[model samples]
Target chain A: MKRKLTIFKIGGRVLEDEQALGAFLKAFSAWPELKLLVHGGGKKATQIADQLGFTPRMIEGRRITDEPALEVALMVYGGLYNKKIVALLQGLGVNAVGLSGADAGLILAQKRPAQTIDFGLVGDVVKIDSLRVHWFLETDLTPVFCALTHDGRGQMLNTNADTIATQLAISMSAVFPTELIFCFEKPGVLAQAQDESSVIPQLNAALYERYRQQKVITDGMIPKLDNAFDALRKGVQKVRITHFNQLKKGTHITLE
Target chain B: MKRKLTIFKIGGRVLEDEQALGAFLKAFSAWPELKLLVHGGGKKATQIADQLGFTPRMIEGRRITDEPALEVALMVYGGLYNKKIVALLQGLGVNAVGLSGADAGLILAQKRPAQTIDFGLVGDVVKIDSLRVHWFLETDLTPVFCALTHDGRGQMLNTNADTIATQLAISMSAVFPTELIFCFEKPGVLAQAQDESSVIPQLNAALYERYRQQKVITDGMIPKLDNAFDALRKGVQKVRITHFNQLKKGTHITLE
Candidate 1:
């Protein structure tokens, strides 16, 4: 049997709520296997940007990581948010270390060039240094990664947490059977929007495509599901979209 | 022969100057030995404090790390400055990993108790996890530490860079022949107040005390020298105070 590596990505909603974050930490620390945690920047970055007199600009749901916004992201995501999660996990007796992608050259990224939009310092993942991460795992430490990467040429780049989680799962799945979980407020993808109880039990590529064509899973969720299906196709054992409270029970997405 | 470990600590003057920092990084990367870098937070923290609408409070040249000040420290020291150094080192082909004391449980600290002045969120080093650091050293990775520690109970603490360097040197010297170097603008401990050419070549405990009494070395140099001698007495092979440009030629301090 292959060793299991679980990668949990907690979204902004849970990160913004103190009680929920604390509860999630408790639950997360209770697991006795090898795991990694990826956290997204919450309202803190926007608040800091507002205080710094720059209104944060977002294009379609993604942040435009301009110079000032990149600094704010570095401070909030890499400093405040990442350290907070590591400390809380420490208090829970989980030896967690915080990391930006620059640390240990864990992830090498390329600046997203001007395709249709100039995303400034935003980066797309180019390579994942799985050996060092595996070393960290073997050392009995849980790595809590912030949504940041580096361009290898002395630049820190803001990355999306969901993409990072999916990419990490794809890479680590080659070494260990990897399961990726994306946690948010909702229990899972709903059959009908705003209907809490109508959670989809399973999602596959064909059904996901059908739902997309029927406008069932729309807007922000489309990209998230696309990334998850990509992970599924890339040898990740499974990907789950669920609430923080129901991390183990959610809409499990698979190729089969 | 035991392996040689040289830990260089760069102070504010070099950090604040882009050209000097770049030059130092180039020189530092040229060295083909085991090394680590500890960086001090320069005026960046004070600028951040001012921007955040608070006058930075300092007593006897030490920052009073209250809650807001600690947040600023975390952002400046652990976030911007640490990542910048790591990225720059990475660019120079040095695999540098940035760490706060919290990372990998590197340095466990105790909150400084109320002694005369209640410095909030300030930590005194209690233990240094030399084994994990030795693991890094053996793995051929240079650890660049920021001036931040954690209480191991979910609180980040602002610490002094010189003390951190000294403590690390003392702890690691038992395993490796460790040399500690503190870098600043001046060539070394100056014989006169303003004479840059009058660099003191050697400093012993007795000479340091005599110079202090004669008012040749006063103000900020006092605590730095104190930490240096403390490291020497605690088994660090040697300690030097020098300019970044003259890292190899500096005022060597020893207990003898």
Candidate 2:
């Protein structure tokens, strides 16, 4: 078998959309050997964060991982959100394993201080290992990694799902030339949100930053792009940001 | 650090009494240097089984986990029961890590074939390594292990919690000298169910058989004794059986 992996990032919208998500997962194994799944649970995280009396914030459209926000992220990313995805795959006859990034030490880092930067308990990925993911794959299982990680100490700090996916994708690509696909509610990388067909066929670093600065792609997309850049820098060949429907198609690199 | 481990056998009764369970977990970590929890969800399992049109049976008072029974077992053991315990601990300032026997290969087993003598997917603990549990304990983290194992294929199968606790206690004993404590609703091993004060202080092989012959210490207790015996035989020196309220006060054994 060729050393190739496909990392599919499913957002909260797709999961909350029960009917579509079920149909999509049911037909997963049929859609080119789906090697790994790096999922994001946006809705659950927000709700849990609110319940915990922590306000979620975004800096440059990326989630600012404040201390409280980190708890919310872990509960959603590791608890509620993680289990739901595992159950879905279970329904679809898949040996879906759910793991917090802390389980196999998937992501490690030096802690960002509680200073002006304000990314409380947040960590930047300094090490990434796909060995645990590989073990699952060898057992004919698909790993659904939750974006919950620890800082080598016992504390659970939150990391962004997009960042988690990028780190994971980069690690996966080191062993297998992989495609990291992120699925959102939108049809694809849209030049115009209202027009579903206005797919931005590809993007380079310069063009991505230009669009971000021009306010063409506001909130959330920026961090995603940053994550995409990180993945590319780490030797990942392909990364796609598109809607759930466009998952089976569209490569994120070609500027069509 | 000496090889001192703690094995907590959490009964289904604890979930029914949520507040008490939570309090107990909070108090449990008072000496959290080494710990692993084995939990049961008989009530939840039975309720789900009944709703799903399954009639649970028992061989010598142990749930005869047929396929249908096993489905409910999964729902209770892995889903509702496991998560609740984890949440309770987390709520009470304990960094309790909940996992099934499948995670980190905590437990390994062989499937009992489907026959008239049905054990369902109920597995015999063929192997268990304390590597992961030890890591958790060393880091002052409490690991709550549910009695769920994967078939090394895609299916998650439910095994008996007592068996899980016994094997785990034995495996970890080499390093942690883990104490195996099984907590139930009833107060201690009763010599007479009607009399709360009839709690047995101690027992030996002969004494256990004598009680069985008299049919006085019957139902559920048999398997527990068998498990205790097996654990002791496998190098685990002590086993405690008690009610939740009398958790700290109960029978302790130093087996031959």
Most accurate candidate by TM-score: 1
lDDT of 2 by residue, B114-226 (tens): 67676666777777757656765666567787777655544456778888898888998877666788887777888897888988887776788888899987877899988
lDDT of 1 by residue, A1-256 (tens): 6579999999888888889999999999997778999999888888777877877777876568888898888888888778778877887888899998899899899999977678889899999999889999989999999999999998889999999999999999998989999998999998898998999999888898898899999988998898999998899988999999987898999787
- Sorted into a CAPRI-style docking class, model 2 comes out as incorrect
- For B27-52, candidate 1 gives per-residue lDDT tens digits of 99887779999999989888877877
Q: Scoring only chain A, what TM-score does candidate 2 earn?
A: 0.85
lDDT (0-100) at residue B154 of candidate 2? 42
Model 2 ranges with Cα > 4 A deviation: A1-8, A11-37, A40-97, A100-201, A204-239, A242-250, A253-256, B48-72, B91-93, B254-256
Q: What TM-score against the true fold does each predicted structure earn?
A: 0.97, 0.63
- B219, model 1: CA deviation in Å? 0.6
Give candidate 2's whole-model lDDT: 0.69
- Compute the lDDT for candidate 1: 0.89
List pairs with backbone clashes in candidate 1.
Answer: none
Docking class of 1: medium
